[model samples]
Target: MSDRNDIDPFYDDRSDPVRVLVVDEAERGERLATGLEAETDRIAADTVPTVDAALEAVDRRPIECLVSTVHGPDGTGDELLAAIRDRYPAIPVVLVVPDEERAREAIDSGASDVVVAESVSERCFVLANRITTAADRYRADRRADRQRRRFREVTDAVPDCLWIVDPEWSELSFVSGYERIWDRTAAELTGTPEDFLNAVHPDDRERVRAAMDRLSDGTSVDLEYRIRRDDDLAWVRTRGEPIVDDGSVVRLVVLTRDVTDRKERERTLSALHSAAREIGSADEPAAVYETLIRTADRVLEFDYVAVDIKRDGYLVQEASTLDLKDGGYYERTSLENDDTFAVRSYKRQETILVDDLREFDVTPADPDYRSALTVPIGEFGTFQTGASEVGAFDRDDREFAELLVGHARVKLAQLQDKRVLRERTEQLERQNDRLDEFVRVVSHDLRNPVNVAKGHLSIAREQYDDDSLEATMEALERIETLIEDLLTLAREGEEIDDLEPVDLATLVPECWRYIDTKDAALEVETDRTIAADRNRLRQLLENLIGNAIEHGGSDVTITVGDLPEENGFYVADDGTGFANGEREKVFDPGYSTGVDGTGLGLDIVRRIADAHGWDVRATESDAGGARFEIVGVE
Candidate 1:
């Protein structure tokens, strides 16, 4: 017996030695086993006396190779070989036969190799070599099997479909993840690689076919197209890469992903953007409501859509896709009732989604609707959508509906602002009409009485030189001055009719001549020509000049100059400036600091500036006097 520590010269160190079971009568089995082990340590030989023992030894542990004689004590070597091959197909079996004919017969019956008993001693090395070769081959086969299984596991776990096809696309060599994306098992596409095209949407079939052709021609392709899964269409993005061999295309690998959700979101955003533009352009609330209903219908494809405006404590249906009934074009629901989805959403000021109206405790406004999604358009109204199918609305549907309602809300708020502005404008026009009537009455009625009093005072002066009569004349003259100031205030409040370029250099001196300046000095520091109503400009200059003389005493110097930086002009006086905080009050109609001052002078100046679309502000001049600057000329 060889010691366990003895290393055989023929054994390879790279791999473990092959274990072989030898079956025969006691003497031949032992002799053959010893001879095989003596030739190489790579083959570990064990002796068994019968076929049953050989089968038992093979099953007891890992046996890489089996060596058995043609006949044994209990059964033929063929029986052992058959059993080992049937149970452990990966284990190699080598048969030792009595003659050449028997060796040929053993080889035909699934034997790895055959050795003749007559040449046993001479061919011992050959037998050892064959055993080691068979074991190495078996290990390689096992490694390949494991690699294939791992590949399948990894590919099957991915969410996208992976497939490998020949250059012609006639053979589908490998496929995985097809069941999930295609809604069909991989077996259905095994023999027919082109059958996937049948699932492509009819409109996209030609384009997909062209992409496949490009892949066959050694060109890579990335494509997004729609495919039909049952009755619904799904968007899929596919990338195909050509596998080239020696500069020629051999196969093509394709990866496909289901992108239906991504495509739907993009579509929703595009539709909403277009809807916003249309809704914003609508000038009236009714037009905005109609556009909202139409856009909601086009985007969601819902069975019914309604827009309700909150008016007079009711949700008045302003627009709807439902047919009008009960001799009215719309319906109204009381907002106090929380049973309806629209009212509930309006009160909460948020979005409400009901998958099934029947399951919810609240009653749907439309009994025919089984699902509903309602969104509030701020305090203005509620926008609602409904469908006849239960559970028809999903998270995506609710989000899309909310987006449309948000756009509608913005346009509604704009419409509301426009309405308020129109109403205020009309109210101001009515007040202006009454002011014109008051101005007319003061011009004719009041001036006549003052004129008659002056005439009576003149007769009294002629009859008797009385001091009381002189006082009466002064009082009547004051009344006439007050009437003239009132008329100027009323007339100047209107918009400037026609604008002609007026030179302040000429107009200023002319206005100073009209004002009763006892000893006041005037400086026309500006020579600029500005567009203005000629008559209105004269009135403005006269009032400002008279105000300066009255407030600044008789010897005040008034300066009129262009504010180049301000793009307008300023009227300043070298007199006692306004008291602290009196600049702001000077423009008020009835604000007067002097007892005899009518206080309408500065007020009229502000109105004329406004009619010309100019901004006016009062500040102290450089000489500690009042400065009124009118900017924003153009």
Candidate 2:
């Protein structure tokens, strides 16, 4: 493995003591300070009763950071955040708010980051790491954008989607995945891609047509639309880039993508999250279990449901609502049969599903059964597939038992916390174990192919000196980097960073040098700074610049400037800005414009920005390439 230490992750050392001013009333201040000190030896929290005292202490000593209550005896953490932003911008600050409202306030007041006091250690540490990473990345991207801005025009022009439409909207040019996406030849849509957009859903076409015309009129716009195709509507995301001679737009060049799956996943996860949070807060376990069952049934498209708790080898069916249930549901209870579903789940500590239990003896005494799901209830539950299980994902008496089992393991963890304090501790430990195992599994499984491919490619490149061979090797290495990124995201913990003022104009250029793009042209210029994670800022730059070089063409130029509406930094390139239908899908994992990328770069950029409380998005660049603007830079 290449040593990242050689890369100089910006901060020479993060081990320096976290100089913190903990503001609170006398008793709570000292007690929480003591707890924080005990939580980490690296933290040196000095207790203070008032915001004035905290400010004085910050001035007295070079306070590296601040960790205080949202509302102390004297003032709130926002007061401290504003004070620090205005006065001691060098020092990072994090607020230890009790709930979401205070966290929101901290975010609004320019506090670096915020964590709930309930989850301080896990959340705060994560925040701190992210804050530092964001600061570094922001610096790197600025540098990279500057370097990319000096390149020639071919790199910018060739990779473009290059759509040109006349005043009547007849297409003149289109390139990059046009035929494969529309399933029609670009020659077929020459000067009339918008006419072909007759397939656009009525409700979306006006906005879509308006955005297209706006871009054609020299004003760039990014839009999402539902295109009517065949007999159905397909979602398309497009970012428009205009070719202008004067103030008027003569032609529109747009990049597009089908974001159907990503949007669906986002919606599903949102619904699941809301349901989970609401159910989790219920005063009764039965209500929580009921909420899970109904939500799972409706959202995930499950057929049947049965929740049971086993004690002393007896079945305590806590919740039972079959998706196909009628009045006679319990009359066919073969679940507790001697050789039945519940019997297997309890005996083997696994979930059992019988797709067709009619084959079994329903002899009243024997109890007949069919498609059934029985899951174990325990904090340490592991819903292993039974050896006697049938097919996987088949209509047959398959391991559908494991489906409910899998989700039940998660639900079981949730239920475990409500048992008792001692049981709650055990459940927490078990949950931690599961999370650790998940992280390890994802890392190891992902890294195996990535490392193997890179290692073998390195060996191949050495053996074959051909340019084509070298090019292949380089692509392989990029894939490996992408895989490694997946592991990085999984490993990232939750925490807020101490807020610090960062100079992006200086840092963005520095990170650009790390890329071995000597053969590719480089130009960079920027004069903007903001509040962000230093490292993530650089990653965002690297991803965006890398994207330009790869897709916008090998030679590109990067320019960095500021946004007026929001104190933000812009990294613009002269590359394929964004293709029609791809403006948003480009952010999805494994989604890439180029055939070579593993598609994790922009994702890392966006996610790191998310963790740091910023927005990184793609837009039309002044250089006629892709533009990535980190908004809310301050």
Best by lDDT: 1
Error of 1 at 499 (Å): 11
Cα lDDT of model 2 by residue, 1-634, tens digit: 1122224334343455555667667787787667666766666778887778877887776555666666444556667777778876655677777788877877888776677766444455554553444344434443454444423233244432334455457646435555444556666664554555666788877777777666655787887778765676667677767777776666666667777666756666666666757665666566756665665555444444445555444554455554324532332233345554555656676555545455655321212223444555543322212112232234322323343334545555655655676787898789878877876766687668767877887788788788987777777666567657766554433333766667766776676788755445655455555666566567667777777778776667667677868767777777667778778787787788677677777777778778777777777877667788877756
The TM-score values for the models, in the order shown, are 0.71, 0.32
**How high is the lDDT of residue 129 in model 2?**
55
Candidate 2 matches the true fold with a TM-score of: 0.32
Give the range of the ten consecutive residues with the poorest summed lDDT in model 2: 381-390
State the displacement of the C-alpha of residue 257, model 2, in Å, after optimal TM-score superposition. 1.6
- Report RMSD (Å) for each prediction in the order shown: 7.5, 49.2
